[model samples]
Target: MDKLKLYTNQNFDQLRQRQDPLADQAVEDLIANPSFIDVINSWDIIPDQLSPDFSPRVRNFLQFYFDKQSLQETSVLQNGQDFFAKNGDIYLGLLGFYSLPYCYAFGDGAEVLVRSKRIVQDIGKRLAETGVFVMDIFRPNAFISDSRAYLTCAKVRLIHAFSRYFIQKYARDWDPKFGKAINQEDMLGTNLAFSMIVLRGMIKMGRNISESDFEVVLQYWKWIGELIGVDTSFWPENSKEAFELDRLIRKRHLKSTEAGKTLIGALGGYYKGNIPDALIRQQVDGLFYFFLGKEASNALGIKSTNALSGNLVDLVFRFSGWKNYGSKKSYEGFRRMMEIQQKEQFGEVIKLNLPQVIRS
Candidate 1:
């Protein structure tokens, strides 16, 4: 607890006030590019274009964001990536049930998501897009010089920059007390939601991820943090530190708020419609309680349910080993689910547009 206090007392206020200057610069450069209008008009990633056409100047300017020139991969990172591929289904499940809801528990961070109207209005599509981003990055040999993952990270970073820019400029209701939109602390917390929280969920489900594996997963996301402009200078080094970090953040920000409730309500509605089976839906709620625990579930207004539902959810996901499921099959199934989500939201698979295009 003493060490935990030290971490919690660190000037997170400074982190909250900061935004990603590199990604913000990239967005500024992009908007100023000679082909800005032409590119925005034509570049819709309907088929998921990994590489988009940019003028030489714009491309050169954006290269630092995508290239990850400083990242050095090792056997541990490769193994971590391999672990994610082998358990793609479980990874996605943890994301939806545990990670996203856990994020919503943070009052201020959830407020930013609430202001992002697209997230509340069409959450299914957002979920699909989020899944696609994760799959792209975690795929074997991802983040290479020409890999789609690099571009995907770059795109997301730009999206964050867009949200920060727009909200600060247009959101009259945004309080200064809420800190900067998409700030550094929030970004790091989100990264933990994907990496450490996912590992914690795996442990809850009876999987025994070794300490080395856990540490490598943290390292893998550190590389991601670098690319996405999250300052990871204080990122946790092991499971113990990770837990402390998560607990510290939760202590500071986990509370009931309209923003958190709205996001979870939308999530529940989307899953309820798609799940179809009453029992599975109950299990979904159980899984929420199971992973998020009492404080977070209550923060999101998740209803209390019998313990059986959570245990059953555990039984459904728990398996003997990491590689029990084939990555290809899991990827295809997940992609199909996302396509259905997109088709439902729009008339067809929706094209990815710049935030400017999206807003316009």
Candidate 2:
């Protein structure tokens, strides 16, 4: 694993400097043809339906990006999809309790999130949109040619570019040392948060996933990483690599910052009252502490919860998770809950913040 260190510093530095050129180019095209922005904002059309009035580069990029010809329906991928289908409720819980909170521990990337008021101010909607994206990719046959999943990925990638555009143009306080807003390294880190970190959380909760299953989950997100413009060449291929990548990233960037605290606090505020038990609800910080571990929780300034509350929260999660592991009813319940949350957060339909144009 020491060999991993040899390439990490140089490669991660390069990745930190890189942004999604394709998506950024599309943003530039939009700026050059402002009318095209109106067309994309319409929220009901696909790339194929765009008229010649749109910039050729933008149209071509949209078609190429949304096309799913590059995705392979291998046995490993299908296994990954099935795994998600069986355990999606647990997966969603880990995303909320572990992966996203893990993300806020990174100081530099948290700065970008802090600058994006929509994410901090509207944490519930952001989480719902993220859940939608994850479900879209996890769905069976989602990677089939020209599927809605690709459109979702394309929309998110472009949204990143738009955030970059707006942040670079505005946000006068943005420091260069953080790299470009939503740089490749940060995106890759976020990808790992959703994939490797979620799996790790499952392990922490006494869930047993085979090594093969774990690798496939990572591979599944590698494919997703490619679709979302993350550099998959740097993506981990196995447990050892994934662990080392997380270690390296944590060593380099897992420090406290106001931005990190702000993001995590905002998230915590949004999840208030989500717990059923009144006593447990009072110790919600215990849930954060349980999944994120002491270091990350401390970094995010999560208040200490009593030992009794911490163990109780862990038991509750483990018990519920065990009961619901592969139940379709549980999956549907989670989906229904998410739909209600989305409706409450973003009108009757979950219209994502940027580039609403996707084929209905």
Candidate 3:
């Protein structure tokens, strides 16, 4: 793939406007691209038996989500893109450590993460690299064009599908009480965690995201959810609806599971040596506490950091304001932290890998 061609954003509006099969064209272009093909083929191919066809109900669910109105050029898009540009690093942290763990709190989902077992050895580096990919795709150009974003979305959907297959084939005797891995509810919960939970975390961290910016961010993630196979009817049209749906999902599915507790411990252990200095580490811990809050922390059994250190971190954000928090210096510091983790853990810049089925 020509790197330059990959850099340009697609004219999403024009494609939507056309009466032709623009969605099909988009998918074809995505898969045909050399870079995307490489990413997909690199994943471990599971036997076809494990990869069953989508049930009719699942097919209808997808159709309902995909048949939504086209995204148009508006101030919302501008504000949404601007929000990312200004606070990309903050959002990165929220997505990486804060919001992502909720997936593990779901018993079946936790089983998938723990059973995969790849995350334990290099959790910090893996998470940081994932964060890097997310930040890259969340950029204004990438978000609108749906180029890199589409690729990332596809990877996420495939991982869920692969995990579902793995669980059904290998863990049939697994306790039915935990529910099915990557079932519709679990899938939607994960999607909500990525979008609504991340947005809420950002606000809790003291970033003053305007209402318009908030809506646009939701819109951006909604599109991502669609690309990643979330049902359209499940997509929230606004933050209020998102929060309601998230609450309902959590009330129904979120619980303390052994797998979740273990994953949390592994994550904390990974961060211990990677954060550079005591102060930074303390700040991170505090931010985690603030974002996760008492209810969630207790649910995951996440230990509290030093109270003073956590408060200090919160104060820094409270006083810094959004612009300063997302300043060039701040972004540089964020990038440097990730780079150091990559070098220390991998001995080089680490490339993102598609999540593969765990054979063992």
RMSD of each: 4.6, 3.8, 11.1
lDDT (0-100) at residue 219 of candidate 3?
78
**TM-scores of the candidates in the order shown:** 0.84, 0.88, 0.70
Whose lDDT is greatest here?
A: 2
Candidates arranged by lDDT, highest first: 2, 1, 3
Model 2 TM-score is 0.88
Model 1 global lDDT (CA atoms, 0 to 1): 0.74
Clashes of 3: 2
Q: What is the lDDT of residue 281 in candidate 3?
A: 55
Residue lDDT tens for model 2, 79-172: 7877887778778878988898899999999998888887887776677788888877776766653366676777788888988988898899
Candidate 1 Cα outliers beyond 4 Å, as residue runs: 1-6, 29-61, 276-278, 309-311, 318-353, 358-360
Cα lDDT tens digits, model 1, 244-341, are 88877888889999999999989878887775345556566777888888878888888755664434566666431223333344544555655665
lDDT values, one for every candidate: 0.74, 0.77, 0.57
Model 3 lDDT vs. the true structure? Answer: 0.57
Q: What lDDT tens digits, residue by residue, belong to model 3 across residues 1-360? A: 122221111421122122212233333333334354344445332112221243343333234323432453445555666666666655665675677776766665677677765677667666865776665545565534444544455455655555555565677556765555555455566777877787787666555656666578777766666666555455666766777766665665467888888887887766665654455455555556667777666778776655534445545544443333443534345556566657877788665555432233
TM-score of 1: 0.84
| Candidate 1 residue pairs in backbone clash | none
